[model samples]
Structure formats: structure tokens, C-alpha cells
Target: MLMLLWNVLKKFDLLSLDNEEEIISHLRRLSDDENYLLRDIIQAYQILQDCFQNITYQHLQLVKTVVEYSNVIEMMKKSDLYSTYGRRRFQELRDNLTTQFQLQE
Candidate 1:
């Protein structure tokens, strides 16, 4: 279900390749949705991966906001989705973010 939504977003250039502000804004909107689901969180993680590919100060700030402001990570930890491919991808995002943050420090 969520994956389908991601594909649509991707088809429209709403995902990772879009502007950082746009992505962050979309994420913020998603986080605010009453029906926000695991797919939304997973999409955010995938966007983070995209942001990491072209690391910038703005992108870094977006990453920080997603990590610090959202419960996505904790949700991921609790979700059975973690047992699937999502888990590995989430871990990669986590590790990449940690490394990026450390290097910034």
C-alpha cells in the first residue's frame, strides 16, 4: 500500500531528487497526518538516503529534523516491517546519518 504511494510520489518527482525544502515540507506534512503510516516513515528514510547522496548544509538540517523531530526511527524499531528489506535499509540510513553527524562534529 505504502510502496504504491512511494511509486506515485517518485513518478511525480516528489521524493528524494526534489528540493530539500520540498522534501522536508512533504515530510512535515506526512508527520502531521492523522493517518500517517509505516510507508510514510519508510519513504522518509529513503529520502534521507537521497539527501545523503548530495550532502549539503540544508540537506543535513533536513536530516537532523527528520531524525530529531520524528518518531520514525522508534516506529521502525517497533514495526514488523523491520524484519523485511525495510530493516536493512533503515539500518543503513541510521548508520549513514550517525556517521554524517559525527563527521560534522
Candidate 2:
């Protein structure tokens, strides 16, 4: 599932596509159990979301990168695995992204 999600995000150019097959293979080897897989996916999503939401403009390129990943963040909110807290955090991120885009305009 994480691989699927990553593939979708990669389509939007939010994540690197390099060695994708190898990454998926390693993720599969890391977890044969469904619960473990789900947990890892959720944790990874949360961490990435938080990172984008808390981004500072100390480096302009980093800010631009986070903005580019906003589409991936938006898609993540649609996942059934997204918890209530995750939904709230996503909303906050969405608002922040909107503000950033507006400022750019």
C-alpha cells in the first residue's frame, strides 16, 4: 500500500522515482504482516505531512519543494487509513499551503 501511495505521489513528481522497484521490494521484506505494513504507512504519512506543515523559509528551495509536495499531502487525506487526527493535521496543512500559494501570487 505504501508503494502504491508512493507511486501515485511520484506521478505528481512529489517523490523521487529512482530505484522504485528496489524500494518496494525492501518495504515488502520489512513487513509480511498487514498490521505492520499499515502502521508503517501511517507513520510515514504523518511524518512527511508534519515536515511539510512545519517548513520554514530558511532555504527558499526547501520551501518550494514542500509546496510542490502539497498535492501529495492533499491526496493522502483521501486515504481510508487517515485517522481523525491526521485529517485535522491535513486541513491545517491545506490552509497553510493555500496561504503560501497566495503569497507567491
Candidate 3:
């Protein structure tokens, strides 16, 4: 899941993209939802990836990434990343999510 998200981010150049606010807003909406499923997490990740294609400020992007990453973590807790790819993938995914979130700052 993390690798997929990272690839999408890299392929889409979401780091320098604009629409940070929109991405953040969408993330907030997803995160706030009580029934957030893995599918929603994937979709939110895609929306964020799409936003990164635009030329946005690094700070805003970081902020958005943090929220999105938080949602990923939360969802992982609910859905169990353990079943996804064992501990190694989970760690890598967590690290990547943190890296992307921090890159915004």
C-alpha cells in the first residue's frame, strides 16, 4: 500500500503540485468519516496524488501529507496492515508515509 502510494506520488509529481487545500480538505473528510474503509484510504491517497501534480507550496503539501498519512495509519490500525504484507512492508509503508508527510514541512 505504501509503495503503491509512493509510486503514485512520484509518477504524479505530487510533491510540487498545487491544490494542497483541496487535497487536505478531502483527507479531512475521509479521516473524519466513522466508517472509513481501506478503499476510502486508497481513494484519498489517489486524490492526494492527483493534487501533487499541481505546483503547490511545500508547506501546504506537507500539511496535507501529514493528515493523509495520519489517515493511513488510522486505517491500518482498523484494517490491520499485518494482513497486507507482513511486518516489513508495514514498516516500509509507515516510514514512507512519514517521509511524505514530513516532506511537506
Instruction: In angstroms, give how far residue 101 of model 2 lies from its true place.
Output: 0.2
Error of 2 at 76 (Å): 4.9
Clashes of 2: 0
Could you tell me which 10 consecutive residues in candidate 2 have the lowest summed lDDT? 7-16
Q: Candidate 2: where are CA atoms >4 Å away?
A: 1-81
Per-residue lDDT over 1-105 for candidate 1, one digit per residue giving the tens place of the 0 to 100 score: 333334334433445444756775766677567687788778777775664455667855665555454577567566645476778777888999999999999
Please say which candidate is ahead in TM-score: 1 or 2.
1
Error of 1 at 60 (Å): 6.4
Candidate whose TM-score is highest: 1
Worst 10 residues of 1 by lDDT: 1-10
For residues 28-83, could you state the per-residue lDDT of candidate 2 as single tens digits?
65445555566677756564453345444564355455555867766775663388
Candidates in order have lDDT scores of 0.62, 0.57, 0.63
Give the alpha carbon lDDT tens digit for every residue of 20-92 in model 3. 5665565666656768888888877677655554555885566457556776767767766677555677789
Candidates in descending TM-score order: 1, 3, 2
TM-score between candidate 3 and the true structure: 0.27
Cα deviation at 103, candidate 3, in Å, is 40
Per-model TM values vs. the true structure: 0.29, 0.25, 0.27
Better of 2 and 3 by lDDT: 3
